[model samples]
Target: MKNYVAFTGLIGAVGCFLLGPSICHATENGGTVWPLGVQTVLPAILPALGETSLYSYTAYYKADSFKDNRGDSAIPGFKLENFVQAVRIVHTWDVTFDNGVTLSSGVIGSANKIKVDAFGSSDTDSGFQELYLTPLYVGYSPSENLHLQTGFGAFVPLGNYDGSKLANSPTGNASYTQEFDLTWFPHPNWEVSVAPTFTINAKNDNTDYRSGNVFNIDYLLGYRLQSNPKVQLGLVGYYTKQVTDDHFDHGDVEDGNRLRKFAIGPQVFYAFDQTSGVALKWMKETSVRNGPKGDSLWLEFAFPL
Candidate 1:
């Protein structure tokens, strides 16, 4: 069991780094709660379950500073403060039929808040609260080393400032998202996965707003150390692109359109057993569209219920 756990963790960590955030089928641990910092890596390990049930929880705190083109601070003395705080709970179950096929499904809910301070004055300057429920569906090891999953989710806007009081009134009236995930373990110690996501807005009342198409991609690649399985490390990257010319309506003039962002970093993980583990990760993003640029740091601890 210890060796299996270590091997699983190593495969998961390496797959996560090579594929970025896209590898979900190989690392799901039924019901477990993860510490705040390491939650970003949670999606990478969802495929490892086999005829088991699990639960997990995760929380995060993030801060970012934005810079504009020519590598200059966009807000100058007023550093546009960007931060995200969120918590999520997940439940997973795996079912194997007599035909040697397995299916897994789960439920996930999250509460998150995003804040942007263009002037570094107060938290009240710009911020919004979001709540969401996601359906988890996965197919595991149809053959020997492959997995696939797909789902649709919605994001509800809980709170936001009025258009007249802000600079970049960037709040989703209501949004729906569709996602697809693919994972492949060509070998026991090497893994890779990819996730591509599309989001559409149900309603957009803000002025200066254009289309509602948003695209996001997550990739991970990881390798186990000495095939020991107890520990592993890998690289992770994420990319986001907006398909339309969208602008925020902040009482004043709106800002932002055709935005693109890419981030790359490292992720490390250690497992105590089949039901417990810890992960630490960091990522930095640069805007290709002269928008805001920043980095994120995270730590996470997870244990199965």
Candidate 2:
């Protein structure tokens, strides 16, 4: 339980956008709570009761152009590069509920640096971003092989926002999110997991533009090598879609503003002990629309405190 639960990956604080706030309404590009390509391996597992752990992620994201609704380049010379470092801490309660369910809560903090070059505009910004608070996270292992977890959280806009800059703030305008994950181990060394999240955005008081609802799914299929049980190799990926239309002044704006993307990559994990490990992965994005087509690289580490 300790080994598996230590991989309860959270990408809750990685949603800051590299573009300015006005782009959210002009191009229908907005930040999301569950960023693509950043979820953990065994996301459904939870730390044992009374256990606390820390997870840190370092990520780099780059995109050369923006895509329109037809999947064509809308901004040919647009370029963006972003780097983020996030730390999350989760603590499982000492009590267990009926049906042998355990409970945990967590918080995440992140700092980001973003640079953008496009439309004859170049700018860069770096600062601490938002705070993500997870008040309740529930975990249940029906058997030794199956785990399920769910949680609720919110993003607090802690960073400053200015509508005039080409490179904007790392924090979003604020949002609420719900997350769910399922992990199943078919064999002793085989793992399969899927985690999905939905976010409801708040109106950006700075711009009065409200983004649409966003949904995302992250998945992993991995196997531990018999020759080296400490090493695991797998495939990881994500899919995201905007489920609703954007709004302004409490009115719906149905202007083909939905965003979508899909990405897949390879992952490698090494366990140093029962409760400590590190993972690295790379994701290449395709089938993108109304957003940037990019690639992301991530290095994640987790351990007990």
In terms of TM-score, the best-performing candidate is 2
Q: Which prediction has the highest lDDT against the true structure?
A: 2
Report the error of model 2 at residue 9, Å: 15
lDDT of each: 0.43, 0.73
TM-score per model over all chains? 0.67, 0.90
Q: Model 1: runs farther than 4 Å from truth?
A: 1-83, 93-115, 119-122, 125-128, 165-171, 206-211, 247-256
Score candidate 2 by TM-score against the native: 0.90
The root-mean-square deviation over C-alpha atoms between each candidate and the true structure, in angstroms, is 10.7, 3.8
User: How well does candidate 1 match the true structure in TM-score terms?
Assistant: 0.67
Score residue 117 of candidate 2 by CA lDDT: 73
- State the RMSD for candidate 2: 3.8
lDDT of 1 by residue, 60-126 (tens): 3233433333334434333233233444443445565664443344433333333334333333333
